[model samples]
Target: MSDTQFLAGPALRRLRRREGLTQAAMAARIGVSPSYLNLIERNQRPLTARLVVSLAEQFDFDPRSLRQDEAVGGVEGLRRRLSDERFADLGIDRDEIAEWLAAAPQAALAFARLYDAAGQGQAATPAAIDPMDLARREIERWRNHFADLDIAAEELAEELRLSNPDITAALTDRLRQKHQISVRILPVDVMPDALRRLDLHARQLQLSEMLDPASRAFNIAVQLALLEQRDAIAGIANGAQFSAGQQGGQGAQRAAWRLFRRHLAGYFAAAVLMPYGRFMRACEATGYDFTILQRRFNVGFEQLAHRLTTLQRVGQRGLPFFMARIDRAGQFSKRYAGASGTLMLETEATCPLWVAHAAFDHAGRICTQVVSLEETPGSPQRWFTIARTVEGSGGNGGGAADAARFVVVLGVEAGQGAALAAARGVDLSASGAVAIGMGCARCPQADCRQRSLPPRGKTLVFDERARGLTPFEFQR
Candidate 1:
């Protein structure tokens, strides 16, 4: 809407054909010339706002259908796909990819699918497929939003009349009255193996004493989702095409499907705890202050961070936030990109310069940074990132040293950073930003002191007489 052209030629052509209307007839109905309509259908011209309104009014269809779905990998996604080293010599530009998407989105999607298959080393057998990757792909396919589950959770939240001060009591009482499952908090020594366990035979929901109030409520919500929203979760999971030809074996497919369903149940649990409408209002009112929102919602840091990524409901959309959590060893435990389209989330190797990695050093405190990523020269993408360390559920017996730690990092586009209270007074300008990359291998940044590996596709330079700031010296 900000003067960005909407060129959905393929969609328009398909709509006209589906309606059995000739170009001239459609043009007349839309108050545009036949030639202009042809141009629009062929991707030579963008759809005017007036024409879109007229088409919607005359056709009685939603205007949202004219735009490409983010799930099919929009311009940013296609650009990332084209940046692969295999296509390095192609020298394809962003504008051409954008036009290609508008002209033939199905073909673009097909290309993306082929790219993904090739990345998987052309797995011929079902057993060769990685179930976890399949689950992650399903989540990314929908941008982490499950509309049906969201609505159901919102309704359930309202019926429960959830309040932050006694959310645990409310959930426990609901489980007890509705499902006849009583909640019991067991001592750590008694239930040392698991945090939360449901005994269907005993009609008891046992929770380890290790869990805090937030976690207790969360586990209860998860139980409720599995019991109440099982059908909805399964319906959503069934729609995911984990393999290209559904060739995966039953075991592999079941593993992927179960993982996907578990994540969906968690999504429903978060939605019930933090209903979309109320959460959106709180986010806007508090300027997205994580601390205040966490307290207000009675949720933990990770729960709040995960919920922030799913605020993509239509007409009440929140900022497109991408989240990632990593341990001290730089291993990513969780990652979700809710339409932010930042390419950094696509890879596991994270740059050490990122504040998320630095958050481990400054435990229990929030760290904010404005970083720039130049995937290509002369076009830098900026992001405002917030990172904070959370105590992992390693049990009290492990002590502080044995207890694991994780850094939850949330990021949004720098242009929207001003809306976040944490980014206030932080310079969002390009010059003030710390230039980071995907990782040492994929990064082309020269002379970075923290770089552990040479950049990919660069020739290593060896000189006995001198050494640079970084350990590896490579050709730029």
Candidate 2:
């Protein structure tokens, strides 16, 4: 595979982008000029052994994996259209053509524009997506869960408050006593053999399944959490409800139920780990430092971020917050926060100022940032984002080709001001400032550098002579 013409420029670009790296940044990591790297991606030049080795050594990437070519959707079909005519006389090499297709994005765009003008119907388009759709879907998942358990969790919270600390520990002991189950770390090879099971006869509860060590540990932690904080978990879960009229379409009602139930369970889990009062106290103590929260709670970045949203539990509320989670390539897997109705999750996009993406720039590096979204309401809210490259379970040689690492971000609206200024006693607008839209479809911002598409619910007016920042003039 190493000696084969298997490298695809788009594949490489995707990999680099997923890692939140630019061509120049990647070149620096591998000791190559950005131009040389560009050529390699364009297929004008093949990657040398030195660069290949550097990728493996620096980022723990496999050389063999880099040799594999990933199909470039939309672009390939367009290229094949002119294949017969473009190089019929030259006898062009297939690899060379692929290189040209992958590396020359600008040329490809020009071709696509021309093709579109000619009514060729190119596959990919420039119109950006609305991320709110994605967020809404995720919120739906949580909403469904919470509906079922809302009342249950709330009732439990008050009742459990009296005995939470003791009950939590006792529950941990109960799982152990009932099943003789104990948490143990095992090598990766024997992880699948680690199962979560009960030995009814011998009264042994064991975990024997080949799981990713980190995930396995977290699951165990969550299980312990269930026992220790059931009451508090229930309290937070049931505290909030959108509206109860039993008056929606069947599909709408069902979706609502599902989301509520899911959110209930998630809230319960969070409560067990970080009780409402305790969490609020910690935030005050640490000034909302996400890393410190991650360490203190022994949870993943996304979990912590999601928990931040639920801080608004009745009188003990902290702030109105918005949370987002994205992978290295800025692909959003999970997103839930307040303001779901307004924001768009159309594309798996990342803010350039987001630090979660930067963490992937260097494996194990923790990057934090406080940036303002351009279109958000009021003053720019302060967001604390963290990123890192983590290995996934399973490996096909250099681990697993499917292993994916993601970046996680959590943010709070400026009830006071930007994160820093507020901390320093500067007054920041809390009410008017809200998260701006990611793209035009969900965003109402007039002139945004990141606007790739038009706002969804706006009237477009064409005035080429006096065009604003957006490609099209729009009415609010």
Candidate 3:
């Protein structure tokens, strides 16, 4: 279940070489023939769980380390390096690059470096990237749903609690009894990089002193999920591996594991805090009042929004919501859609009219509107969108007010907007849905007043005397 169908031929060969053993010797030790090992080395066969355990027992190798996607970071380096528009028609997607990394990591790293070197100054600036982005995109492609983890988390939520109460205590007790680990809060100066650290040798789990009470509780819940619900996460990940196919490379697999753990943790925490049955009733009764629900669960806006996206448990499902959070610069830091065919653009924002762009001006005020995508005018993808500014903890110097402002936008497709408290008085059937664009490069609107650049596929015409709202006139 732990993505055991990994094409670990490269890994196996590496291990054999590292141990200074020949194919026959290594194969004999692992209870396999040299010819069989040869097939694995060539990536023609997947390493079975039985063989993996045998190797671990014989060589004292950490199975986890062996299974980890080596040069996974290099895959990202390659992605960023190759994403330069210079190689726009490279004929290989990110998944193909991931496959190259898995099949041959050394070559992949070398290729990434070469690609980076070649793209000297091509105007297509590589965006600041999250290491987990590859996995995030892959998960989003699947609509952020992991049936196994969701089912298990829901069951665990019901078994663990009565209502939205005592989450930290419950998780702490679980850790203490199940994993023999005690939770402790430590200063940020002591543990800087991470909010939580597990000291397995000392049987202690450390939470950063910098985190708020709710965050501290969430950290505890996450650790509990990792310790208790590991198998569920692995099962979902294994399933993703086959479904992913080419994307299920070494680096991508590594990222997938992290995303699965993070997602499973979130699901578990949300389930515990907002019990499915109870939360469903509350959501309907309160008309999905976000702030009210946030108070009831003692979770942050981001957490509340994330939990709302996962309310797809068949009979007690809530509105199919799509939520995203971005910095003032319009970089999406977090994103999820409950259903497919999202109206939100995943790429850079070129449209100044999007409510998220306006959210920065009106801090703390929820801005809601029924808007349609500018790319497809009068398209049925019109969504009821609400955006607001959220301030993070300003730990560097000033107070919380000085912290970075992130805009959180939550939207539901046209028909479901009326049930939302934020959507009050919004006409779902209105023809006045404002058109939006993906970005300047992708937008085809010839009449955009604020257009910065012409669409990629169109030829821009320059006129000497005549001036229009757009600087460039396209040739159809």
Best candidate, lDDT: 1
Question: Cα lDDT of model 1 overall?
Answer: 0.83
lDDT of each: 0.83, 0.50, 0.68
Superposition TM-score, candidate 1 onto the true structure? 0.85
TM values, all candidates: 0.85, 0.46, 0.67
2 or 3, greater by lDDT: 3
Once fitted onto the true fold, the runs of candidate 3 whose alpha carbons sit more than 4 angstroms away are 1-133, 162-164, 242-249, 374-380, 391-402
User: For each candidate, how many residue pairs have backbone atoms clashing (under 3 Å)?
Assistant: 0, 51, 1
Q: After superposition, how far is residue 311 of candidate 2 from its true place, in Å?
A: 1.4
Q: lDDT value for candidate 2?
A: 0.50
Q: Order the candidates by lDDT, highest first — what do you get?
A: 1, 3, 2
Q: How do the residues 232-310 of candidate 2 rate in per-residue lDDT, one tens digit apiece?
A: 5455434422222222323343444455444545666555455566677888777776668767755555566666666
Candidate 1: regions farther than 4 A off: 1-37, 45-71, 83-93, 120-128, 162-165, 244-250, 397-399, 462-465
Superior candidate under TM-score, 2 versus 3: 3
Clash tally for model 3: 1
Better structure of 1 and 2 per TM-score? 1
Angstrom error at residue 455, model 2:
6.3
